[model samples]
Target: MLSSSMRHTRPRQRLINPFARATARPGAASSSHPCPMAGRGAATAAAAWRPVSVLDDWVAREARPISLRQLMVFGRSLTESRLISSANYVRTELPSRIAHRLRDMQQLPYVVVTNPHINDVYNLYYKAFDTFRKIKEVKTLEDNDRLCEIISENLKGHLTVIPKLAMGILECRGLMNPQDLDKFMNTILRSRISRRVIAEQHLSLTETYHSPHFSPGAKLSESDFIGEVFIRCQARDVIDRCARAVTALARSTNGPDAQVPAVHVDGHLSASFPYILSHLEYIIGELLRNSVQAVIDRQAKLREKAVAAAAAGSTTSTTLNAALNQPPPPIEVTICEAQEHVIIRISDRGGGIPRDELPYLWSFSKGPKSANRLENLGQVPRMAATMQELHIDELARADLKAPSYPTPPPPTPSPLQQPPSAATPHTPSQQNSLSSLTSRPPNLRLGMGLPLSRVYAEYWAGSLHVHSLEGYGVDAFLQISRLGNKNEQLTTRASMDAV
Candidate 1:
């Protein structure tokens, strides 16, 4: 059992948002007491630019009035607050290079951070936060419904920006000191914990708010208490959509009508309870894509051998063509539910991730092997979007609180874009893990898939892990916690001290 202190979650109605963070701009008004390390934070705070406010034009559409700017400020302010704090996160544990990077982040003027990806993430956050802050006013079902609409809109916006944000962060990774990698990793971990908390709170609140039978300040029914998450995820339907996405992607890469091996689930498709669908779609899509690619490559090789045999007079031409046309083995998906968790296993026979690459399966850094390619993380998402084309708008639809966000753009090759040859191609399981569903082939792969997926998987009380059999295949296990009311965020030092 967790301590009472651990169970303390930020109030859902109106979060105690720091006024200073209400705008991504640091010079904004103050709310919460000053930081404990005010002496250390003063310069960074002073140098921080005031957060920008969007032009608010209240427009009523479909009987719902949307305060575009307030929502925008809400999400961005939350992000800015976290990031501003993260800029100095675990200062004592970091070395100078990373520490400097963290502090420098606080000092970055809004104008200097010109990337659309960076800007969009903050924008979405501010919007979401603004909506979240208004939950207390949801005494009536109509108000709750309005709140849901705004929240969904912000989530859609999140899809448009997250990959870009991840890419932007990685662009400067090379400047990180080797010895301080752990420290940098810690910073990301904290950020992930914060994101998870924010997702669960708002998403769960959405479930309650959108329900026709829902009531404010009433005891939540046990049956409906998964808190708006991990509920009624149609595994069969999800598989169908993902399979279509995979097939379409495969055909486009190999041929307009190329017959890639289909994905085969080991059991009857089941509906999952309390799971985020978009994130699942991404995970499953990536696994199937790689599996299909491997089967296709294997079939091609078999055809090559058969053709050579035919020339050698050992096999008939007709038999060789028949052998060449046989469908590759289907990738198997296994879904199992326990009392407290939902587990999905995706198995593929793509000649398993190369043995040497196994250890780094979870890493995002461009190690020594691809040093000569000279591409940074910012370009990987664009490349992945270009080749495999996993971006789909349907995934952003708000059913179970709009899972994660939308995917990267379609795979469009351009002279400006560089393929992920800088590093070894990641597998299907990892390909769609966090970026685009596109993974490795003749040369393409989702460059940031595995690490990103891990973030999502671990965001809740869940896990994503890989088990590989070299020269045979790989199985990725994704676990989603079925329990509810987890700690919304990590504990702060101040909280711990009080405890």
Candidate 2:
């Protein structure tokens, strides 16, 4: 059917198997037909089914940039037409972003690309990109409705992206340098954040548009929420909620008698701004959990030393009793509302981070040298599926549940009934048994906590900093921009491999 010139033209690289296989020759199935030649043809067909280069067409397409301020303005008075426009924007933007990541993966060294975890992630991204790029134009409410369904399904399908990416990087750590790995990870995570921001923003707007209470033309007040962005978000309220949730979690995991420290929140108690509540919860919750755990561990060490001294006859009963009864120092949180930002300081008196671990504190490519990091990495697939799933309330939904502790035995009826000394308080057996390295509870340690928190904070033009006092404690500073006018920082690096 082809013209002479067309038939003689050089063939384009067959990237993606778009066409079905050619049918076997007539009577090829009979005994007379050569089986080895047919098998060879099929093998060649399978080997040539490459699809990596096809993503370039989509990657060449540009993504429409979006900002938080724009989100708030558009969501303030969402209408049906606006909702449809948002849906289309998300549909087109997501594919471009997905394609970009796919290209980044394709450009990796063949060895790294072939890693099982990375290959699985590549397939998922390709599937999502293919499905999204196939959607028809949205011109009606019905069309938008179908697009929403598709978006939801895709979002659900990509839930394991974070863990899969982490595992892949860990496996390929030796194949790439630290700087290159960090850049690749930052690009992927930031791009993901941008995509989710638009996708979720549109979904929320659609929900608000259909709500009975929504009045498109009604004048809105500063107290109202425009989709997921709150016009006046209470900073302290979210911190308190996350603190309470973390406190409850600590007790349940450490045992009934665990000495969880109190978080003392002060300054600018009523400061409010336009922000996303879920984001605030995650950042604050992670920081607080780290602080509380540090304080608890510090106190436990002091108690153990006191008990050891008492056994060795090194101190008087008064001093020993004081040490035994001492509670964990309170964690202090100060909130400051500036003209254009909200700055929070979380100060804790837990023994500071080990000096050796400080350099890699915020580096995801190389975690601190500890067995706990590896254990936590192993649980990522079961522990975390999505950012929202990191919230305290969602902890129960994870498959790796915390172990239960038996009730502590009642005080000894008589001194003889107990061992040589009855004065020592019941040792925190459950807490001590759950070593950071061997514990089964995934919440206790996620190796990527500090790094992920930093990414989330920086995603919106904000920042997170940590200062450790070596043997004293740690102070964390979090800056949030209330203006929300900065564009997202997404990288467009083609390849990170060294020449």
Candidate 3:
């Protein structure tokens, strides 16, 4: 929890928002708008500028912890007065949360602070803090509208933050010990999750308030959303949905003809719980994708070894062909519902991770050895942003709520089947969005998925664990709290004794 206290505060200065200015020059002809070069120059100038004081008085303030039940209670009976109150609460609360995080970043060691990716993230936090700090109290509907636009833009701008932080930390792995490194990352990531919840929740509330179907004092169901959160989310539905989407991603990545394994969902199939939809989708999708990929790779490797042996006359051609033609085993997902938590186990026969890679499995630093070759991979993949955009099919993109999953795409020629001249490389711009599903090999393996998925799980007092059986397979256990009363597991400034 963040506590409020006043410190000696520096005089406030009016800040110029270059992005806003360049895009909103009043009464100027469209031709007179600043060119790209001019905009870049403005951005550079903004980047170089910082306030005299890094810690605002608000940094010491205390804010109440948010709970799922609280959100539902607030959302159920929203009137004009309640909306305005919510707006003001959000307006003040966001900066306070952001301020504390900014302080946490400020306390980092100089070496860690100077890492390029960390520096970029630090600047982003500062800009967001400053932007929110400058906004006058949001009291009216029009004021709330402007605040929503700012929130939306900031959310988009911070999409790459998780990847950037991971990359920077990976580069600085040696500077800090594993314990401190995990501490710092846990703090930052949990803070990131908290900030997004407040901003996104407010945005959703505003949207609901303005919807044509909205009535100020009418009865609203508990199922009525405060944001992307669902009060009574169906767990099995999310798991099945994410499984299908990840299957499509696998097919797209490994080529259309890839034999992606089927996902078998069992145990507590009708379980419902209160949770954020996107968060659940992201965690489940990442775990399933990993399992699916592992299955595909293991099967392919088996076929290769068998074929090589057959060529060496150690095995018959008939036996080799039969092995190669067999379908990979299905990925098994079992959901067990308990009084306080929902436990999901995803088991895959994808030949478990090697012993050497286990130490760095849930780390931001000490990523996969392949991470060193990131220059060829463009930027580290955006985890949160990409997860938000994950879909089972093209049609799902159009209607995320109540998604109508379209028929899976028909198989096309694999690279080996196609003529050599037919395969072209995908550019970074084309592969950035998972919606494209055309990422080049190695770009998708930054080693952030499982670690970040753990963060999302732990954010709600849930847990994720993976157990490998070496040559046989791997099992991932995910526990989510259905109670929805656990306060966010946040690290405060007082806890910043380490790196």
Candidate 4:
């Protein structure tokens, strides 16, 4: 049911991080690296004090490169030390007063932007540092700044090259706290959108099918079907919980921009479709959660900028106000029934999936860019080895058949000839021992819920289907068979009697 626009072109492969490759190579010479202590003196300082060169060799020798794990550890260590150490020092030291200013601004009702030039400063430093580190070529601050400016001005050119991992980290910490409930609401919206799209697509595919006949008089008495009601009610409860979770997430991330959308159904008539109500509710919840998170992430960056602007005593509050005033993303759900099947659709207004990446959207394996990066980092070999082991185990299990139960012997007539000895008589505990050997409930295992639901539905001659989008949402459907001819005749007679 996904749109063709959701398909994204495959991104060009990135160059492997040579530093990672160098670190992994066995017997690589560690001695060629310059000593870290040699960079202290002044004139020799500029030449010997290349931070990247000194750190790279030290990291290579230590067998730990600058990865996310290393960064987290470094940050924790810095927080613990607290002292103004050379390790944590930036070349351009901002005034300590700036920290006090930010702390005060945090108490305000809205975000404060303290430094408009902070991004420029970091960009300048990164250019000089990156060129020196990556190419092992020395460059002046002026040269680096010009190059950085050029790249900055053409930001759209580097969209694909920008690491998604880096973006995720920035969104998590620098943007907004995701733990808030409103952030989850957007996720539900997304799920609803996906379901709507799928449902509409399915309807279009079978337009020739007749509309389903509704039998209003065929309702069962409440007392006769209490157990069935309880089961259906339990499913409804889960669906309601999912809806609340999505709403919370959306509100938290959207800040003042969040708007809770009203849920609409084409009456409860479609509830007659087997499993449709439960599946629709649950999947809508999941989609809304994803959408809420996406909106929160997207808006967090803007909020950070707003905060920074407010801190700087800038009078231009228009940008921040505009961002806060924006409306929440839309999620739509639609349902229709056909003679053979019922269809449900959910759609979202959030940015659609990229065109080229659609082929692998439903794949269980790593996403396109992530998988490519993993391969480049030499993780594919280990992953392949693990997969092989799993396959071997599966094959072995498939070769073994289940053992058959033995038939019981007929009762002997001689048993009535004499009373059994009381000393060897079986007790209640002994009699119940065989009962304990029976299989326990299967719901205890992870990943079995969907399959178990499918099994129960199938018992009544039904089929279950699940459709999902990684960054978008999920849709689940169940279809039950129609009643047999004799049952239909009986139902008509019963309907006449009730009338």
Candidate 5:
């Protein structure tokens, strides 16, 4: 977590508040105000000058007002001292004016400062400046009371708001779900575009390193590859631009009424493909659409409930407005690397899949057991036909084995039997023709994305695996041999050219 305290560390010279000198004490004489040189004589003048000099030193040391650097140092010292309880109470009770200023200061970046004694001095400075500011604001008794009341209210409000905001931000960025085929596809698609951009950028950088006219045969090292990867990873503007493109597409399809969706990328080298980049953009768009629909559905349900509740004069009613005001759960993305594969997981902390239906989650078929039973019946007729064919073949073979007995009597034809015909052996051309017809495989149905992906992987001499944890998440993995150096170089060159 990023610390808010680090912001409060600017030099006192930058403080905006003006300092005022303290007033002198009441006069003891008409011509001079307790001047030892004239009242007590020259002997005590040197001693009087000594006190003034000491006072001058004190004023010089305390001249500067409070600053952020002092406050941070103070806060850190208090933390180190294990005075958290006291520090927290003070932070809460701190005057709104001072606290607000401190907050503003906290927004600035500062280098970390150590030194416990200096920190203590810094804390004292902050406390003193806060007290001074309060005194300066207090023009009347009523104003003081009002200031106190306002500070009290703000402190209470902050206690609730700060933690919630922190949690929301964390939820927005953290990873929670297992990686599945959808995730892999999405990642792969996004990575493809990113890789292309990276490759282009790499080419630009390569030009800076050496002229393109230089030998293409020059050996490229691993450092070059790693450097390119690092640059792509660190390029925030590029990533944001890609995300914006995705968001725009999603909004165009889903409409202006839809909420802005969160987008994240994950995985290692496997997820860094050129094709995966586009797929990721598309998947994100679809997921955002689904989320919008879910929200709309929930709202409709709530409105209906509210209407019913109003008619019945019931106090309890779940309405869209009420739900909209409530905080929604966070979305998360997790990235992990394992042997020969990478996993990118995403999860939304919304209402999960129903427990009762979990067992059928990964089944190609869905619905009740009766429906499955009905499906089995459709296969029974085919099985019966095959059994009957086998029985006929067996009978024919038995008859041929008992040739002596069979010659005595001609067999009676059954209703199911066909008249005998002359047997004709298939010629070579006919056999080849039959073989060609039988050898052709059946056309598969479309939208079998998982199987299709597996086929693609196998085509590249790789493998794809998937597992879904119902009501939880899904996990997917793709395994492929590491590209050889020569192949990698070729790929790099091709990628650069495409870019």
Candidate 6:
């Protein structure tokens, strides 16, 4: 299959968000059932079944910083419990849990905001809350599919708010009480993580819900139980696509960047494992975007200093010559594989994240990327997207077959359909149809990418780590576990003591 990166380079009009497409019409050639298929087939009516133990645990853990470790455990425990039961069972259990989450998120309005960025955080909580409420109403496979559609339509807008919200929380920390702030952060973080897991499990169950084996009389196998929650993913190609997307952003025509920075890709890259392609695509693009932004911004700073030196007549010829002669180091990615895991290391020497910033690096409440200057923060991501579109248009116009022979782009990878390989380019009809389903390009304003990527990695028992030296560079480590047992039943890890 073609890497998702190649798909983003195609000359196509922008869509609201990728994954917003549904097979406009179900195919006539296939005979299949629809919605709520396979898992344990049983149903229980929704009830106000709030467990006292859960409430007690919450009350007991008051007025103190909540460890991230505890949230992961709680989130995973909930997911495991849901996955063991049927779609109907999980749906019946949703109301009380969602009610608790809604109460916590409802408190976001009380938090004070010192800047528009902080307001972004205040608003994203509302976004999450509304999404949670809608999710609670999903009691059937059809409802689950509809919920996924709704999320796709809203994902880009919500994502655009993440970086700003993350920045805002930190900036407004002074205005909020210490205990309130910690509880707020903990509550929201745990809620997001839990909702994410539940959403995923529902999607999985809905995928297998219609098969004959899902009927009450027929026994379901492990494969029928979980369906394609995980699959063999082509990892190297996804990274390649992300790299090209980064390049397109660098050379984007509609952005403020007047000069392009050099980009290079090297090392062994071809590898595959059982995984979710979209999650990997999202994680990689976000990380690479951070690297590209740092490199370009640093390069711009050096240029400004050089021009200033020349204007002031203060530069010794040797210093100017040396500066002009040396090229910036290329951002590097190294991928290593093992029987059980894939390790990807992305390194950049474009100056490290500041020391003071390190303390807040992974926190959603950390300061915004533009806290010192928020005026242009929102415009930054839009500009990058615009720049990418312009670049693709230029490429199309410059092609030899400008009229009837524009070079075709790669096909979008789809979960419900087969995707053509990169070597055999997708036809224009297909491209136009599936363009919206393509993986999204890198976002420049997304400060939450690192933390979010970790979520994606951890969802599959993988990990993401950031190691940086103040003046030198940052190295991000991504370790993804190999294929899970194809026929294995869904269950929580035997030992979830800590990450």
**Top candidate (TM-score):** 3
lDDT of 1 by residue, 220-251 (tens): 22122232232345566666656766665566
Clashing pairs for model 6 are: 5-241, 36-209, 37-209, 37-210, 38-208, 38-209, 167-367, 167-368
lDDT of 2: 0.64
Give the distance in Å from residue 132's predicted Cα in candidate 6 to where it truly belongs: 9.3
Clash totals for all candidate models: 22, 1, 5, 57, 18, 8
Q: How many backbone clashes does candidate 6 have?
A: 8
lDDT of 1: 0.43
Q: Which ten residues in a row have the lowest lDDT in candidate 3?
A: 415-424
lDDT of 4 by residue, 230-338 (tens): 1122222333344444454344434434555433334223233222222333234444444445445545555677778877967367866776666645454444455
> What CA RMSD would you report for each candidate?
15.4, 13.9, 11.2, 30.6, 34.8, 17.3
Task: Give the Å error, residue 435, model 3.
Answer: 8.2
- Winner by TM-score between candidate 6 and candidate 3: 3
Best-matching candidate per lDDT: 3
Better of 1 and 6 by TM-score: 6
Point out where model 5 deviates above 4 Å: 1-215, 218-246, 260-320, 350-499
Tens digit of per-residue lDDT, candidate 2, span 76-98? 66677788888888888888899
TM-score of 1: 0.53
Cα misplacement distance, residue 119 of candidate 5 (Å):
82
Model 2 ranges off by over 4 Å: 1-50, 369-371, 382-444, 494-499
Angstrom error at residue 344, model 2: 0.7
> How big is the positional error of residue 92 in model 6, measured in Å on the Cα after superposition?
3.6
